[model samples]
Target: MTDLLPLWRDLLLGGFILLAYTTEAMTGFGSIVIALSLGALILPIDDVQTVLVPLNICMTGFLSWRHRNHIDWRLLGRLIMPFMLAGTVLGYWVQPVLGGALLKVGFALLVLWFVLRELRRAARGHVAAPKSGWWSRGIVLGAGVTHGLFASGGPLLVYGLAGLSLDKARFRATLILVWFSLNSLLTLLYLNQGRLQPLAPHVLAYLPLIPLGIVLGERLHHRVDEVTFRLWIYRVLAVSASALLLASLLQLG
Candidate 1:
């Protein structure tokens, strides 16, 4: 029983990481949110966060490299990075007190809201983005906080990006750069708090699958057009958001 337990745990962990990273590679975000929400059911949320942060940073860094030329360095430096870092500072402070289960549930609720909002936008045939200004900045900062706390800030950030009217390649590249920078800080924070020690072995075991998922995801990203991409993104978000919300509610019950 003991031997079988570890095998099952590793399998679940590997599967979640593969799926999440693939999504991240294709979309340039969503890996941490997707993986953490699902992985929390199989492993402790804190442990999953610790183990996955480093892996996510590494994966995003790789994707950033792969699409280096497409990154919006100006936007990342001027707005996204600083705002997201600020959010992480606040998120880290409140995380310990909020408790893991509540945090996960809250993140799921947030994602659900974004998914629904995007669906409504899509259905209305609304292509012109809202004007970019303070409101847009607020959205990005809000995404930063959620990201800092739960690592699921992609959907909110996507809303902000939509307003910028970026091309598909720039969108993915910019997201990869933003996550790489933000998650690098998160990894250091995890290390300082000693949250990563126990996860060392699991990290090594899961490392091999990371690149495989990224390669496959990269292929998919290249093939997808702007319209098809948005359609697929929301579809995935709706299903995953619903699943996470359901899982969190079950935990409460």
Candidate 2:
């Protein structure tokens, strides 16, 4: 019973991770944002990053490699690379320094931003997102840093891509490519600093399920139409955002 109980717990968490991955594979983002905040419900905050740091690496890299044939190399190099590097450095510097409450507030703000942006976009006739330039570049860079500091960086980077009105497959493949580089770099940094401890053992145990989940998700994603999938995306974004806001406020209060 004791052994089975632990297995169940792991499965439960892995299940959550799986569902998050499904959305990412299906529509190409939100898993991280949703997973990061939702992970807090199942694990301690410090431990959340520890577990996710490795999982993100495995998931991001695998998905990217699996779908690499579909990735836009230009988009990745131009938009994702510079910002992720910058964000990682900044995250390392700032993460341990911030007060818990303040950090929670910042996290909540990001969640709110994602929720609002998606809602607004949906309301604005679901038109494509405007092209980003200088400010948006900085936005992506800042988001990259936040991703390093906190795994929830999905809202900033992923939601921004919605403006492009990419079809689900393109969005999924491109995000996997970007996250492969971003999360891999962050994972290495964490490994160097010794934050990669408990994650590996847990990740190894859960590794078998990722491939299964990806295959299943990919099939379903291909089956869905663009409009339906996107509505589902917004639904999740709104739910996660509201959940994040409540969680952060509860923590701060």
Top candidate, metric lDDT: 1
Per-residue alpha-carbon lDDT of candidate 1 for residues 159-209, written as tens digits (9 for 90 to 100): 776757678888889998888888888888888888787778888888888
Which regions in candidate 2 have their CA more than 4 angstroms from the true location?
1-9, 99-101, 124-126
User: Residue 107 in candidate 2 has what lDDT?
Assistant: 66
Model 1 spans > 4 angstroms off: none
What is each predicted model's overall lDDT from 0 to 1?
Answer: 0.80, 0.70
| TM-score: model 1 vs. ground truth | 0.93
- Give the lDDT of residue 42 in candidate 1: 78
Angstrom error of the Cα, residue 183, model 1: value is 1.0
* Candidate 2 TM-score, true structure as reference: 0.86
- Give the 10-residue window scoring lowest on summed lDDT in candidate 2: 158-167
